[model samples]
Target: MRSVEEHQAVVDGLLPAMPAETVPLAEAHGRVLARDVVAQVPLPGFDNSAMDGYAGRWAELAAADGSPVRLPVAEDIPAGRTDVVPLAPGTVHRIMTGAPLPPGADVVVPVELTDAGTEVVEIRARPPIGSHLRAAGEDIAAGTMALSAGAPLAAAQLGLAAAVGVTELSVRSRPRVLILSTGSELVAPGRPLARGQIYESNSVLLAAAVEEAGGIPRRLHFVPDDVDQFLATVRAELAGADLLVTSGGVSAGAYEVVKDAFATLGTVEFGKVAMQPGGPQGAGTVDGVPVVTLPGNPVSAFVSFEVFVRPALRRALGHASPHRLRAPARLTSSLRSPAGRRQFLRGRYDAGEVSQVGGPGSHLVAHLARANCLVVVPEDVTELPAGAAVDVVLIEGALQ
Candidate 1:
């Protein structure tokens, strides 16, 4: 059996780097930037007022000597207004917040400091020069790098891009993944189950996981234990797909449809890894799209995705940190694992303690759903006592 790192290396070697595409800024949120975004225009665009007040020459206002200095308002300026006229030498201009400051104006006095006059304003206090003013390019300069490549466009980043007059962006194209779940005994949800039928869920589970990993997922109907049908289905879905992910039928079972269909294709290699609950794994390509085949069990399929496929998707989409957040926590109970296989047990971590959520069974989907983390046990050690420090991969939000 292969080690986890060896299998991961095989899987990572198969994925091609995603190409960049141009997208409107409205659609760029959550997408990774493909190139450094240079500022098209300086932030604030021009010298503007940071508050609603009077824009005047600071030397004229200071000449009043702590008394109320009345001056005729030269012009009224509101935000987004063009046709701004220069401020008269001795008069003040009524300006609104974000309005462009008139030429020759050296300072702004907030309306609260005066009598809030519109025609003839009373400046009760003398503000410092350049007070309440936003200079051009103060926050960001034109032609300077605003955002770097490989950074995810979050809300603040998007707002900054818009502030710099950016209407579109170059970003990594989201990978399109084709998902298939294969099993003869599998039945779709909301349908009647016969004697030995179980509702197929791995496709939906994996599809959601793909979306969370920043890939677009297209789920195909479940393929039964027939080699011809499986091959036909794969061929049909190969068009326009960047990656292929299949759950089930790769194990050493009598009716392993995926293995029988793809074993002859020189691109795919089927094998086991030194990991519990997700030992059976496969990685290769069909046609030109990369293919990853996970084990049949639900928990095993999900764990395989978290360990291998999710990081590949993130890396292809230009993410820098492409793995789950891992931290160490003290074990709440004793646990045991096989001597040679590394164990990823379903667990719930809180504060500094981690407790096993369910027994080490691959079929326990309920327990897996309740788990927010995977308690990692190394292959070298078989037993862990309570209070032992264990490494855990956090699948949900951070432990509180």
Candidate 2:
């Protein structure tokens, strides 16, 4: 049996680095930047107000000592006003938030500090000079790097790009993954199941996983356990697919159509890894497209994807950190694992403590859904008592 690390390396090496493509800023969210994005113009391109108030010279307000100083409101300035004139020597301008500051105005007295008026206003208090003014180039300067290469674009980053007049961004292209699941006893959900047939769910699970990992997923209908038919179905859909992912049929069973069909081609290899719930694995090429075969059980398929395929896809997409965040957590209860295989148990992690969610069963999809983390038990250890510190791979909110 191959160790888990060996199989991980083999699977990760299957796909080459993806090339970059220019996409509209709207579509670039969740994609990794291929090149540094520079600011086309400085943030806050013009001096603007940070508050709704009156703009005037600080000297006029301070001349009143502790008494209220009244000034004529020369003009009312709202946001988006382009035809702004400098403030007269002794008059003030009524300004709203984000409105450009007039040339001679050096301070803003918040509306709350002055009598709210349109034609004339009374300033009750004096504020420091240059207060409540957003200076041009204060946030970021023009021609400087706004976002660096290898950064993942999100809402804030996209907003910044838009602020700097960036309409398009160069990002790593998402890999197109063709996904399928195999089994003779499998039937689609929402259909009545016969005595022996069960609902097929691996395809849905793996397809969502692929998309969550930043790969484009095209899910093929679940194929039956016939070697010739399986080979034909896969080869037909292999066009334009960068990677092929299938679940089931690679295990040691009599009618393992995936292993049987791919073995005949002499390109794909099948083996077992020293990991519980997802030991059976395969990786190779079919018609020049990379393929990764995972065990059919829903939990197993999900775990295998998290362990192997997710990182590989993220790496191809140029993500700097492709793996899940792992941290040490104290166990709330005892657990046992097989002697020679590493175990990844569904777990709930909170505040430095992790508790097992359910028994280590591959078919317990409900338990898997309730888990926010995976409690990893190494191969050398068989039993871990309560309060023992073990590593946990955090999953909740980790995709971002």
Top candidate, metric TM-score: 2
Can you write out model 1's per-residue Cα lDDT over 143-187, one digit (the tens) per residue? 999999888899999999998888999999999999999988889
TM-score of each: 0.85, 0.92
Best by lDDT: 2
- Alpha-carbon runs more than 4 Å astray in model 2: 63-65, 396-400
C-alpha lDDT (0 to 100) for residue 332 of candidate 1: 92
| Candidate lDDT values, in order | 0.91, 0.92
Per-structure clash totals for the candidates: 0, 0
lDDT of 1 at 300: 98
User: Across residues 1-400, which tens digit of lDDT does each residue of candidate 2 receive?
Assistant: 9998899899889988899999999999999999999999998899999999999998888865699999999999999999999999999999999999999999999999988988889889888889999999999999999999888898999999999999999999999999998888889899999999999988888888888888999999977677888899889999999999999889888988999999999999999999998999999999889999999999999999999999999988888888989999999999989999999999999899999998999999989988999999999999999999999998863221
User: Residue 238 of candidate 2: its Cα lDDT?
Assistant: 96
